[model samples]
Target: MGFTTRPELRGTFGAVSSTHWLASAVGMSILEKGHTAFDAAVAAGFVLQVVEPHLNGPGGEVPIIVTPAGADEPIVISGQGPSPAKATIAYFRKLGLDIIPGTGLLPACVPGAFGAWLTLLRDHGSAELEEVLAPAIHYAENGHPLVPRIANTIATMRELFTTHWPSSADVYLPNGEAPEAGKLFRNPQIAALYGRILEEAKTAPSREARINAALDFWYRGPVAERIEEFCATESVWDVSGRHHKGLLTADDMAAFKPEIEKPVSVAYGEYQVFKCGAWSQGPVLLQMLQLLADTEIARLDPLSPDFVHLAVESAKLAMADREAWYGDSPEVPLGTLLSSSYAAERRALIGETASMEVRPGSPDGRRPILPPLMEVGTIPQPGLGGGEPTVARDRQLPNDSQGEPSLNKEGAQRGDTCQVSAVDRWGNMVSATPSGGWLQSSPVIPGLGFSLTTRGQMFWLEEGLNSSLKPRVRPRTTLTPSTVHRGGVPYLAFGTPGGDQQDQWQLLMLLRHIHGGMNLQEAIDAPAFHTDHLPSSFWPREISFGSVTLEARFPGETVEELRRRGHVVTVGDPWSEGRLSAVAREMDRGSQIIKAGANPRGMQGYAVAR
Candidate 1:
C-alpha cells in the first residue's frame, strides 16, 4: 500500500471518525462509558454543532443512516426540515425574486438537527439526555480553541454582522472584532439554552420521556417561541439585496417531526450500499455505482486517466438525473431510475472523449423534465453572505467564472457541511452528514445564539418540477451519508462535507477501496477529483460544461490526458479536494474487529480507536 497520512486505526472495542478531532474524541468518550454507537453519535453530533459552528449548528439538519446490531437493514433518520407553510412560489414571485436567496430569514426552514438527535437518542440510544448534552454545553459555556476556518468565516462576515445583523455580532464578535485563530471562543447563549432544556427535561419520569420532553421544549416550548418571534418581527438583509421577514412560525415547528424510514439500497459486488431516499442526493452515489457495475473498474489503475474519466462521466450522467428527477415529492420514479436496465442503457453513453451536454435518461420510457438551465457566468460573484462555502483551485475570487468562491490563503473555504461515523462493540453503527444553519446563512436569532437553516434555497422557482418550491415540502438537500452492508451484515459507514462533491468524493473513495484494493486510509489519501458539469444545489445556481477539478497531487500526464479528451481541467492545491472519514466492522476468526480512517486535508479530521 502507498504511504498514508495516518495509519488506519484497528481495534476490537470501538471506532469513531469525524471531520473535527474534538468531536471524534467526544464520541470515543461516549463509547468508553459503555453506551451504544447511537448514543455516541448523538453526543458527537451535538459536539460537532459546538466545535464546527461554521459548518453546522443547532438549527441545521442531519440525515443519518444507522443499522442496529442484528438488524435486517439500515434505516434513515430524516432530519431534513420542510419549508414553512407560507413559503410558496407566488410569495417569492411577488417579492420580485426568481430564486431563493442563499442566505437570510426568507429561506429559513424548520430547524431539524436538534429534534433529530433527540429522536435518535430516544429510540436507539441508551444514554441519558443530560449525559449526552453535557459535553456540548460545557464546551459552549467555557470555551474551545477556534479553528482558523471559523475565524476566517467570521472575519469575512464581520462587516455584515456589525451592520445588518447585530444579533449575530453580539454572539460571534463578542469583543467587537472577529475572534482570532487558535484563540478560545465561547457562545454562552448556547450553553444557557441547552442548560435550560436539561432543567426542563429532568422533570420527566423516565429516560425516554426525558428525551421526548427535551424535544417538546425545542419544538413547542421556549425555543420555538423565540424562533417564531424573531422571524415574525425582524426583516434581515440577505443575498437578494433586500430585507425580508421569514415565513417560519411556531406552528411549523410544532408540526415538524423527524421521520425514521428505510434506506434505498443497490447491490455493488458483494456489498449492498444504502443511502437516504431521493429527498436528498444520496441516490446519486448508488446511480453512479450501477453505471460502473459492468465496466473494467477493477482492472484500471485507480489514479490513471481511464479511471478518472470513467468516474467523472458517470457522475455527470447521475447528476443530470438528479436535476431532472430528485425531490421530496411522490412523483419521483426512483424504482425505474435505480433499475439495472436503466444503468446499462446509461453506461453505453460513455465514449472516448468527454460529453459536454447535460443528459438525463428516460427512465421507463418517461421523458425527463428539467428546470430552466441558467447559462454559465450568469450569476454574479458571491458576497460574504452566500451559502455553501466552496473549495476551488485558485486563491483569487470567482475561480470558476461561474460564481464559486475560491479558497482563502488558509486553503479552506468559510463553511460547509460536516460528517461523523461511529461503530461500537455492540455492532451498532451510524453515518451522518450534518449541514446548513451556517453562521453566514442567516442572522442569529435574538437570544438563540444560532441561525435558521437556509436549505429552502435549493428549491427551484419553476413549477411542475420535482424540486419546485412548495410549502411544507423538503428541498432536495445535498447532504448525504452512506452505509454499506457486506453479505447482509453492517460493514462500513462513511461520508464527506462538500455540497455537490459529497457523493462524488465518496464514490471515488469507495471505488478505490472496493476495486483497487486500497485500504480506507489510502483511498481517502489518494488524489481527489470532481466535476462542476451539473447544476449546483446552492443559490445562484450555475453550471459549468465539461469542467473537472483535480488536486495538484494527480499525475501531470493524467491531467493533460483529461484535457486532451475535452475536459475543462482545473488543478487545485495539493490537499484541497476532500474531507472524507470512514469506519467499518468485520468478523475475523469468530472475533469482531473495527477499523477507521479520516481525511488528512484541512488538518482537522481524525479517527480514534482502542
Candidate 2:
C-alpha cells in the first residue's frame, strides 16, 4: 500500500478521535483545559450526538470500555437500554409480525445514552455536569456545519417527515425543505430542554449531586413525560408494512439505569483484550482470537490470500456462535464458549474451502438452538429489514419517500454510528461506540427533538433462545467498543462503527499490529477485508456464503488466488472501507506520550493531538 496521507497524531498531554472533526476538537479542548479523560469523552460523545444526528442521537445507546489509571481490569459500562415492559414476542406476533420492525416506535427502547454518560462523568470526572454538556448545547442551540450525507438523508426522507412524521419535519425539515449541506443546522428545542435541565442542576450544591439530578430529570421528570405522552399518542409508518404506536412508557424509562460491570478479557501472549459481556458482540473478538490461536498466521504475509482466508473462516464460525449463543440474558454459555479447548474443537472446522452452512457450537455440553437457516446466496440489501443504514459503502444511502431513489446515487456512500476514543496524560483511557436512534429510525418525539433506538430489531421473536424478544430484557446489541491493557497498564483504545462489520474491521487492524509489527495508524490504514458468510445481525438477517470483500489495493494474483480457494471475491476501492480510529500510549522521555489516528475514508472521521 502507498503511504498514508493522514499520519499518526502524537501529543504529550492527550489524544482524541471521533466521527466528526468538531467533536474531536471539542474533546481535545476539554482535555487541554485540565479536565479528566472521562470528561473529554463525555463532552465528545454529546457533541457527536449534535453533529452526527444521522448516525446517532441522545435517544441512542452507547457501550463503553474504560480503564482508569492503576486499575488492573477494564470495566464495561452498558449504555445500552432495555426493551419496554410491553415489548413482548406475543405483542409483536399479535401485530401479525414474526419479528419486530427494524425502524419505528414499536421497537423503541428507553433512551440510555444520557443517563449512561452522566453516570460515568459524575463518578469519575472532576468537571461539573454543565461544563461537560455545554459544547453540545452550544452546537444544538446555535448551529454546526451539516455533513453532506446527513443533508442528503434529510432530503430523501423529507416527504416521509412532512407527511407521516410532521413532528420530525418541524425539527429536521425547517420551513418544509431539507437543510443544505455545510449550512448551519440548529435544533433549538433540544437545546431548550437541555438548558432547562442545566438550570435545574444549578439548585444542587455539589457537582455530583447536580449530575445525578440531571439523570433523574431525563428519566423520570419532564423529559420522560414528554416522551411517554408522544409515543403513547403518535404512530408512524416504518419498515413495517404499517404504522404502529410505541411500546415504551415513562415507567420503563424511570426504571432504567446504566450498569458498570467487569469486562470479559482474553489473553494473546503479552497483550490482554477486554470487551463487554454477552450483552454485546464485543466478546466476538475474544472468540475470534481464541479460534486463531493455533494458526501459524505469523508465517503468512499480512496481505496474502492465506491470511485473508484464515480471518474470514474464523469470523464465520465466531459470528455464527454470536447468533446462537450471545444475548443480554445469562442463558448463554459464554464462559465455556471462550475456553481454549472449545476453540480447539471449533477451529478444526476451518477447512480448505469455504462452507455455506451456519453452525454454532453446543457449549457446556448442551445443544444450542440456532436461528432459522438463511440460504447462503441470499445477499442482504440495505434497509432490507428497514434497519438504519450501516458503515458499509457497498450499500445505498437513504432512498426518497416517493420510492424514487436518488438519481445521483452513483458513488458508494460511506457509513454510520458515532465513536469516541480518548486517553489523557493521567493514564485514563476510554473507547465508546454510540449508535442506534438515527433520524430514519423512528418518528421524533414532538418536544424531545430525538427518536428512540430500534435496537430491539436485533432480537429474534422465536421461542427458547438466548436473544428471544422479551419485555424489559436488554437486546443483544451490536454496539461494541474495546480497550486493551498490558500488565495492568492501559495501552490502547480503538473501535469502529460498522454494525456487524465493526469487530471484523477491528480484528484485521489488530492482527496487523501484533503480527506485522506495525504501529497504530499503519495497522488501521492497511487494506481491510471481511466476509458475508454469516447471517447479518441487522434486519432481514440475510446471508451470502464464501463472499469476501477486499480492498482493490491487494495484489491481483492474491485476489484471484482467494477466488481459486472456493471464495467469492469482490473488489472495493482502496481506502474505501473501514471507518476505524484508534489511540495508544507509550513511555517517552521518562513520561507517557499519546498517539491517535482516525480513518480518512469519506473525510468524516477525525483525529488530533498536541
Which one wins on TM-score?
1
lDDT of 1 by residue, 539-577 (tens): 667777898888888899999999999998988778878
**Which pairs clash (backbone N, Cα, C closer than 3 Å) in model 2?**
391-415
Regions of model 2 farther than 4 Å from truth: 375-415
Q: Model 2 over residues 454-572: C-alpha lDDT tens digits?
A: 78887898998888888888888888898887665788999987777788888988888888987778888888877777655655555677788888788998898898888988787
Model 2 worst lDDT run, 10 consecutive residues = 398-407
Q: List the residue pairs that clash in candidate 1.
A: none
Q: What TM-score does candidate 2 reach?
A: 0.94
Query: Model 2 Cα displacement at 217 (Å)?
Result: 0.6
**TM-scores of all predicted structures:** 0.96, 0.94
Clashes of 2: 1
Error of 2 at 184 (Å): 1.2
